[model samples]
Target: MSSSALPKPQMRDLLANCLRFHIVGAIIVSLEVAASYEFGVAEPRKKAYADSTKTMIPHKDFEERRKPGVFQSTK
Candidate 1:
């Protein structure tokens, strides 16, 4: 067996993959931000409108509670 051995090159591959992952992530985030701004799909006006118009539709449990009588499963 030789006293000297080649050093492991695993770190180089790991670093390259990490850099690539970050670059891809950055690109995806940038594109998403650009698309959001371009389309204005997430504007506050629409959100406010939705919030203002939001309402709760009562279900079977609510009706049963309101009557205050023997419980019956509507299922």
Candidate 2:
């Protein structure tokens, strides 16, 4: 109500600064969350290797071995 309390330009500047501060803070928080997700999420799972030199059976041989008559029983 009193002109001496605060001039119009200073009041406008103060209000503008407050709004800008809040907006900048929100943007910073959102960027921080995005950065954290980029760095922290989606780590690749490590496979355990008991014998690194062991080779996998060929697909054709594996299929034939599964057949009952194709593989003879030792007993």
Candidate 3:
């Protein structure tokens, strides 16, 4: 279905939903940042994040090149 076929209310609802989602996300992220600063464990959290989130090199989906990065200081 093309967007032009949709009613104005539907478009308004879609835009409102998107705005609400972004606002909620921003508030949650701000709260997390405030908590992180108050707790003062940024270094440990950074190391943990570095260990968990992988930066995978581009590869075909059929081939699994699951290699852990070697540069993490915590490792």
Candidate 4:
């Protein structure tokens, strides 16, 4: 029995595999970062729309005098 008899991957093969894995991992991380940035960029537009909707509500007197009918329309 000798140390060389044991089945093991060559150092070069192991290093190559590790390098490939790291490269793939880096690409995946970059894509995730880009997607997160795009989503964050759209948030302000969404917030603006939400703010406009809130401000479109009628004032207190108009709200009080508005009809309670089901077919009411917003002008």
- lDDT, candidate 2, 1-75, per-residue tens: 766775456645787899899999999999999887766663311122323224555776667776756656621
Segments in model 4 whose C-alpha atoms lie over 4 Å from true places? 1-6, 42-75
Identify the superior model by lDDT, candidate 1 or candidate 3. 1
The residue-by-residue lDDT of candidate 3 on 14-63, one tens digit each, is 88899999999999999999897867887778877887656544454223
- In candidate 3, which residue pairs clash? none
Local accuracy of candidate 4 as per-residue lDDT tens digits, 1-75: 666776775867788899899999999999998888778877778888999888875675476656555336853
For model 4, what is the alpha-carbon lDDT of residue 19? 89
Candidate 4 achieves a global lDDT of 0.78
lDDT of each: 0.76, 0.65, 0.69, 0.78
Clashes of each: 0, 0, 0, 0
How well does candidate 3 match the true structure in TM-score terms?
A: 0.39
TM-score of each: 0.38, 0.39, 0.39, 0.43
Candidate of highest TM-score: 4
Instruction: Summing lDDT over every window of 10 consecutive residues in candidate 4, give the lowest-scoring window.
Output: 66-75
Model 4: how far residue 54 lies from native, Å: 17
Q: Candidate 4: deviation at residue 15, Å?
A: 1.9
Quote the positional error of residue 3 for candidate 2 in Å: 19
Question: In candidate 4, residue 28 scores what lDDT?
Answer: 100
